[model samples]
Target chain A: QQQVKQSPQSLIVQKGGISIINCAYENTAFDYFPWYQQFPGKGPALLIAIRPDVSEKKEGRFTISFNKSAKQFSLHIMDSQPGDSATYFCAAITGNQFYFGTGTSLTVIP
Target chain B: SQTIHQWPATLVQPVGSPLSLECTVEGTSNPNLYWYRQAAGRGLQLLFYSVGIGQISSEVPQNLSASRPQDRQFILSSKKLLLSDSGFYLCAWSMLAGFYNEQFFGPGTRLTVL
Candidate 1:
């Protein structure tokens, strides 16, 4: 079974628009949630992360909104740029293991 | 600062051939290591993980196996490669301080089995 589920297999946005990708998990044991960005032929890099204690966290143009009761979290990218075109993945960590969402391919058109 | 490395960034092997992929971490000790495989434009599938030397955990039952020979060295091996084994392999490590920590990933190894 997929522990974490992400919506919108792909997304497209114009420059300066807002892009959002959402993920949901059933495991309440997850204590940490992180978002990763990956360019083609490269490793995924940590973009932003949030703990369950906080409902929201923002880093520059990237923001993570987490809802514990709903068991959901969403990543918001503001002012999307062409350079931001890449794949994004949301992951939940519990114990020493990580459960990842399938992934979302985001494209920003200039 | 710590960094991870994976050798033979790209590999192409015929079916039934033996395979070995190596991953190492520098400037860190006793890190929690992980191995993942990803199909084209797909999500990451956790294959194996290790928290300590000589300690390994398999998340999925497959033809592949993993070993942690040292504090920072992790290896993935397959006695006989299958066409289904073709994919991008990734190595990641996180601090052992607590259950929750950011994972650092290596560039990844692309394996093509004919």
Candidate 2:
């Protein structure tokens, strides 16, 4: 299958709280996984990415926890702020094709 | 830096109208190109991809088609658009130099069919 399913269509977090979003894919051929962050009326920007060879990768306050055995990955935000409110997307790439998750809208209330 | 662009930020068409959307990339040569469509609050759906000039592989079959005439130009066209052919169109590109496949997206085009 080429589907990358994401969970929690929407989430609400408070200031200084951690926000988590999950995604799972069926195609095992995928080796590159990347998460994207998008603001209102703008294109999605690359956030953080990880390879299946590693279980986790962190960039500043954003981290990707990847599980090879479960064919799943997740994005975790540390000490989320109100400006972090936006839609996030997870994508799986094979060679030239990419499969994307449904996306998650996150809101951080101050 | 590299940038991807899509034309006519927004469009509205009738059901029987023909459609054409343009996408171009700057600062990159021989990059892999892609076309995607997204519904309101939904994820991006891959429509087609091109590896080189005149080479196109479609992932979904609907009332749409794609073409790559030059190295950095990709176009999405339909002879006759249907009511369901309206959505947010995005163009993206990634370097084919190696295994790195992080795609960069464009501002996106909103199409409304009435």
Candidate 3:
């Protein structure tokens, strides 16, 4: 069973435009939600993370809007740049284990 | 400051061959270590995890096996490689502080089995 589900397997946006990716989880036990960005031939890096207590968290141009009641969270990138073109993964953690969503590939067209 | 290392960035092996991938963490002790496999353009699948030396937990059953001989060393081994085993292998480590910790990932190793 997939504990976390992500939508839009791929995305494309023009430079300076807004890019969004969303994820949903069924496990209420999940308390920590983190987003990771991965470039080709490299390891995924920790982009931003949010705890369930917060409704939203923003870091620079990246923002994570989390809805506790809906069991959903979304990543928003403002002023998307070509350098931001990569794969994004949303993960949820419960206890010591993590459940990941099947990544979303984003392309920022310059 | 902590860093993770994975060896043999790339590997190509014939079917039925033996395989081994190594991962190590530096600048930290008693970390929670994990192994994951990602297929081409796919999500990561958790393979194994360990919280201490000689303690390994397997999430999936297959030809693959993992061992933690040292506090910071984790090894993935397969007695006989299969074509289905071709994928990118990743090693991650997180502090044993609690559940709120974020995992640090290594560069990963790409394995191709013919």
Q: After aligning candidate 3 to the native by TM-score, how far in Å is the CA of A99 from where it should be?
A: 0.9
TM-score of model 1 relative to the true fold?
0.97
Residue B56 lDDT (model 1): 94
- Per-residue lDDT of A40-100 in model 2, one digit per residue for the tens? 7678889999999999999999999999999999999999999999999999988876888
**Candidate structures ordered by lDDT, highest first:** 1, 3, 2
True contacts kept of each: 0.85, 0.74, 0.74
What local distance difference test score does each model get? Answer: 0.95, 0.92, 0.94
Q: Mind giving the per-residue lDDT tens digits that candidate 1 earns over B13-75?
A: 999999999999999889999999999999898999999999999999999999999999999
lDDT of 2 at A23: 97
For residues A7-94, could you state the per-residue lDDT of candidate 3 as single tens digits? 8899999999999999999889998999999998888899999999999999999999999999999999999999999999999987
In candidate 3, list every pair of residues with a backbone clash.
none
Per-residue C-alpha lDDT of model 3 across residues B29-81, encoded as one tens digit per residue = 99999999999998889999999999999999999999999999999999999
Worst 10 residues of 1 chain A by lDDT: A92-101
- By lDDT, the best candidate is 1
- Reference A-B contact fraction recovered by candidate 1: 0.85
Distance from true location, Cα of A70 in model 1, Å: 1.3
